[model samples]
Target chain A: MSTLNLTAKAREAATSGDYSELISLVPYAKMIGIECIKLGDELVFRLPAQDGNIGNPTLPAIHGGVIAGFMEHAAQLHLIAAMGGQHLPKIIDFSIDYLRAGLYRDTYAQCQVWRQGRRVANVAINAWQTGQAEPIATARAHFKVD
Target chain B: MSETTIRPRAERFLSVLKHCQNLGMTVEQADSQGLILRLPYSDSIVGDPETGVVHGGAITSLMDTTCGISTVCVLPEFEICPTLDLRIDYMHPAAPGKAIYGFAECYRVTPNVIFTRGVAYQDDRDNPIAHVVGTFMRMGKVTQSEALTKAVNEGRA
Candidate 1:
């Protein structure tokens, strides 16, 4: 457990399958304003647009690295929620494909755990701004589960 | 060749990236080989509070930005190149309390795409924290193609 203490309510939420507390524990996620929501059995990540997130002011697009980071964080959170917090996965490698420029607007990501072995897991993630029909980026990540 | 001519252009290009400024990335060196960018240590980017390790996301940003800068150095004129794909492999956790540096080189540039490879290290180049390979889609008109050809000729000269 990290030294950052979660309120009893947050702990309760975690026990009830809400992962916002677990996501909040990550310092970078906090820096970038990442939020998690549980919709039925699915977990989705959201990143609200901020002035600091813009990489190219001319296009007014979100930074490519920021979009990649957000997707990576989403994969980690999805793994945590799936594993029931038994272990924290360490990223081994990440590959991202930028399909389109991430517009300066709210971005959402959904992760699908492709495989979860005893010692490793592979996750695929897609991020979209306007709708899921067209994703801004897609990523695949491998993590070491101990 | 003159600092008076190159420095401001580089600085002006970097100023447009707000996220780069937020991460406090600075151009440490730029030459024919490539460009080296430094990312100052910041607590705001720590991924593991327990170990105080900077987040991998920040390192990715640093390398991506370095690759972009390296492309600029290789090209004759500045152009907007969006990252088409990037792959990063982490070798080890970055040491806390030390600034990370990313050195990137553009290896190949075609009419529409640029290929780059980079390494992120805290202290020793041989001992890199991460290795990154990326492709960027070169946007804008083909006028810069002549500029790139001239730059290559100058390098060989």
Candidate 2:
């Protein structure tokens, strides 16, 4: 498929709430096995428990980098879904706080766009395993949206 | 600070960690000052296939791993020090098709926390791709499972 057509399809998928299609266009998201589920206008990301993601074999915990990456990808996809644009957002910076050791289980993340200006956007993201009340990690990211 | 003792332990720890192995990160140097790790170029880790630039996530992982390894080098014994918080600033996109190196130093090690600063670069140390500052909570010694211990010993051997 041509690049223009792919971008158009991705834009359409974003507007029509076909998150899976939109995510498919992102290579890193697919590489890390990020699954998207839409609830109303909000999108949640899921990272299935995979053995390859394990960092501490003794504790059998998911890699901290995997968690951070998953959250960052979630924020980027959230922006794409919200903006309905073909342009990929460039990350300016990312700050992540690891609240707890991510266990060897499926992890979920949600993003909140705090502000979307003409040239920049800020997003806050949280990831958890069992409950949203107890997040395993939280991250804030800035993106050059132009 | 015995370089002989800490260097071998750091190597063993990195070899045992699956995520570090997955990223193909190898320790380049470990001493009292800090630790340096190298991440070779791989197409599998490219974030933007069009430009073939390495993913920001890959660089973040490398920095985090490097910082943790540096912390281990400074500690007297093996312990599980999880990242409490990490902040990364992307100075520039890494040049495509070159191995990236991450230099990390644990500047402070208190009873409960370890502070680290790291920089990722490709060709020159002055021109870094990203800069990271992080704090890790010292969670005490890891429960030495036989499997984990055996892997560390084998790595040392």
Per-prediction DockQ comes to 0.53, 0.55
Please give, for residues B1-157, the per-residue lDDT of candidate 1 as tens digits.
Answer: 4434344445556655789999898888877677788999988888877678888888888887888767776666666788999999999999988999999999998989999999999889999999999999888544534443333334321
Worst 10 residues of 1 chain A by lDDT: A5-14
lDDT of 2 by residue, B1-157 (tens): 5878777777887887787788788988888888999999887677766677887878888888888878867887667778999999999898988999999999888999999998999999898999999999887755644456566556742
- What C-alpha lDDT, on a 0 to 100 scale, does residue A115 get in candidate 1? 98
For each candidate, give its TM-score against the true structure: 0.89, 0.93
Name the runs in model 2 displaced over 4 angstroms: A1-9, B142-157
**Candidate 1 wrong stretches, greater than 4 Å:** A5-14, B1-7, B142-157
Best by TM-score: 2
Task: Write down the lDDT of every candidate, Cα atoms only.
Answer: 0.81, 0.83
Tell me the tens digit of each residue's lDDT in model 1 across A83-118. 766666788999999998899899999999999999
Rate residue B60 of model 2 by lDDT.
Answer: 83
Q: On a 0 to 100 scale, what is the lDDT of residue A82 in model 2?
A: 75
Residue pair clashes in candidate 2? none
